[model samples]
Target: MSGSFRGEVRKLLLHPYPKRARDQNPSREGFPIRPPLNNEPRTADEEFASDTLRRMNEVLARIQELEDALDDPSQIWPRLRGAWKRAEDEADPRMSEIVRQAREISPVLKDLEKRIRRVLRRTRELTPLDRVQEMDRASMLWLSRQPGRTIAERAGPAQRILSTVRYENFDTLENRVFHSYVRLAALVAREWQREHRQAHGSDRFRLVDTLRLRCRAIACDLEALGVGLAEPGTTPNYVLMQDRGYRTVRQNWVRLLRRERILDDLWAWQAQTWTDFAVLAIVLAIDELDEARPIAQSPIVWRQEAFKGRWFDQDRPLAVFWLEETGRIVEVQARPEQPGPLLTLARAHVSLRVTDPTRTELPRRIAVWTPHAMQRMDIQVGGEDAASRLSEIGQVASGEIMRDGLILTPAQGDPQHLVASRGKAHVDVIALDASGVSLALGMEALREFIRRDIWR
Candidate 1:
């Protein structure tokens, strides 16, 4: 028995059976059986080989069950413990590989949920411009805490005085303007975070400077109208000037006071504010440049597959797959020469039409790429010839179309209800007129460009 067991173990460890041995054994009886030789029967090697194969399969089946259990997320810990037990019992090399793979996948699966939530929140925060204006108005109410006070009543004179302080011959206009606005912003942002101010970059100073200048300008305007600051500024303190300026600031105050109550009622007529959109436009400008870098590196023809199935190309380490309208979009290895279809999906889905026409003599031009081949046909669409054609189009499209006049107006007044019956409307008007060709080719792209880059 011991001799047979020793031979069986040797066969299992050393080598596989030969073709003759394989053909001879119809059924392995936990050991191989040689066919009847002319004189000799079976060798100990054949019997051992057959028995070892049967035992190996049994071991494999057991290991597979443990692997399946380990893959069950609910039983992962128990499966891991079980796998370790089996590994300890069997002392096999394959068990270690399974354990290592499970450990690698666990952390990856755990973090995926966290990453998805962050992306969703980011998308939610990037809503359209209308929402931003509404938020600004809401912020005013929240800040002032007085429903009766109009924005102009509160911020208009303050804004003018800030402007006055900025330009005032205070010996160091830049330094004074910087610190004065700094002080004013300190008051406005007292409860907010240092991070908020940090994020505003130049705007923190600009915000304060603009406010103080506006207040100072208002004070000066009141002086022009024969009104004086409530207190003379013999004091060195800027706050003293600020306080006096606010108290004495006047701008047809009687009309303002009478109509201040109506400010609440006039939301329906308030001009669509462009400040928020302006900020968005600036961000989009950066986005455009960043986006263009890759395209400029290696230009590829990308078409939008919008009508039927949607596809995106993602580059994987191994290969790039041209994903089609199937529910599952697979990552593909990108070719060296061309970008995949996924690359142009943004152009089709998102609008990036640029309307600004800087001089052709200058290095950069807007709308470098347009959906319409005609608009993109020439590199210098805004060259003299193009500009001339655009000017003609602008004249025709120049019919007055009155907009919400509030945010557009420089000074305080009831929001505009007038139509742009004639004359150039704004920078946006000219850009759109020029984009008429591009718009005909792809309105989505043109609208996105105007709304984000120009109109805003």
Candidate 2:
């Protein structure tokens, strides 16, 4: 019985898979079925390839999103940071490429940020003067780095001065005089800057030195006219300092007024008074500059009649003169009409005369009439053959009239005639008759004539 039990146990252990062995080979038991050794089945390899491709597509999609975000200026830094962090932790080699591109673009992004901040600061600082648009902000940014604080700071005070002068309410004469002063100031400032740069070559210099000598000369003139300067070491209380030339002018004017005990009169002064004084100061300063040159042989006058009584009338002449080198109007003198008072006054009072005939715009035709001869002579002033015409007229007349610059001849035909001349910069038309010469046809008249005749 013991031997039979042992034999049963051995049979059970040896023949445990008898059913599977009966169906298949005993060596194949507990082993997987496979394709041939040389040609493995493609299913597993295909599945693994598809899964890898899907993971790569996801990575590529994330990279594309990151690239698109980096194109924006505001998004550049943020995307770069995120990309750098991802690259540090990532095992993917593609992340390293993205990190390299981000580093390449980092410098350009930083520069753009700096420029934007600078422009914003400038816009904020300049907001008090005017509504600073983007273009104005850019201009201010560029101008802030210029030589002086003039352009950067002067606009506000200039506008304020215009308001104080009541520019919008100016009359014809006042407007002309005011604009002439402005032009003169601008020209002087430009020349001053040029000369300063040439002399100093980027070395720092005082803004006041630009007009120091000129201002001193004006101060001397004011002192001679019974005006006094403020005490030395006194603080300069003037508010307008943006334009060195303008501030110098205003300061001298104030000193003159204070010394004359007429400071309060400025508020009550006529617009014409303001115009005359301002123009006079600017002309004197410009005359002292080395760049100025005489432009006219005789001052061009605009004469008109002012009625005094029922039968009495006076002829007023407004003389205009300019500098040849700068082409800037330097002097405008108004006086009672005489035979040739402008030339005499210009020589005696202002030391300004027209020496360059080519630079001056003389009347096209200068007519002189003698009551005894009862004849009007037309003297041609400007043309291709102006010199010969003047010589011919000079021979026909007695002699040169008015400072030996003008020639007069007797008109044989008509007593009353029209003197036509090509208009110059400020002088438009000049009409000379037996009584006097008239330059009343100024820029405004010419514009009106153009609007009526030429434009039509």
Candidate 3:
């Protein structure tokens, strides 16, 4: 019976309209009646099949309407309203029941909408990229809906931010600000280094002091923009503690500075400056530390660890350590152990100290020693002129040197001979090499070397 019903449905689907009049009228006048073609509708069964198919189609359409109403209960309101109006007009018996069902379902629909809104809000907060994508989709949908309006007139902030012209402007501004900071910092550091060198003699010039001056200068610049540093009593401190203005500006700056594009630019600029070496080193070190244990998990504890037993908390880990008599910077990672004394006896993974400044002539011979291996690798610095040779060496080393150490990989030599030089900034590396040499590379040459070789 089910199979027969399915066959009837298939026949109806295959030929929805009535058969041709000629095909249905198989018998001609005064002639013997002829049987219908196998594929043609038979006149005897045509009327009954068409009537059944019509009823079946009506039932299927009604079922689809009910399914749609169930899928979105909002559709039920209009349907119920129409049904109630029809019942009133026709004086139907189900009018009261229909009203009761609608009243019960309305609140459920409202609650579902509320829950959907809440979930969407949370999703937007948790996944910013999703929010951006959604915003773009919404803009496109809106544009399609209102074909009369131009995109510029209807575009949201997200759309504006994504626009080619606007994004290019934003990129340009970011680069300008970043380069400005680097240029200002380098200028200040150069002036301070010149004064210090003049006062204490070139041999006694301290990189840490020069760095402090540079940081103070940068902090001053930031303060001018009404963004306070993490430190207190530095500059004018325009951003008051716990002030809403400060919070707003600080949050904006944090978001801007945290962007990869901005940070990468800042890093490239820092690499170009000799005095900014400590700042770069500190940032890199903190980044390494944070990777070991995420700073977000315990920011307060991380701050304490970062600034423990140092000069100003601002320069604690890098510059402050360089100021010490030993000129050493040690970063430790403790093992799970038994006794307190055993913990004390454990050594740091990175233990670096500055050595005495060595004097060298115009074709200077510089050797670097790896801490573990204690093997020296000689670097060849030679050119047409002393200035060119120093420039060549600085180019080779460049941003590789840090406050704690310089990273060296000797070409065609033993890996053991590769070493780090402590308490020397990239500029210090150039200066130390050029100390006794006449017509040596100046600070500008070293800066150019870093800009050309390292930042590139």
Q: TM-scores of the models, in the given order?
A: 0.14, 0.15, 0.15
**153-211 per-residue lDDT for model 3 (tens digits):** 44444434221111112112222232233333334334333323333432223432343
Task: Check candidate 3 and list the clashing pairs.
Answer: 406-421
Tell me the RMSD of model 3 versus the true structure: 41.3
Per-residue error at 104 for model 2, in Å? 58
Each candidate: what lDDT? 0.25, 0.28, 0.26
The local distance difference test score of model 1 is 0.25
Residue 148 of model 3 has an lDDT of: 39
Error of 2 at 165 (Å): 59
Q: In model 1, which range of ten residues has the least summed lDDT?
A: 404-413
Candidate 1 error regions (>4 Å): 1-229, 236-364, 367-447, 450-456
The alpha-carbon lDDT assigned to residue 194 of candidate 2 equals 32
Q: In candidate 2, how many clashes are counted? A: 5
Which ranges in model 3 have alpha carbons more than 4 Å from their true place? 1-261, 267-456
**Candidate No. with top lDDT:** 2
The deviation in Å at residue 365 for candidate 1 is: 3.3
Steric overlap count per candidate: 41, 5, 1
Error of 1 at 400 (Å): 34
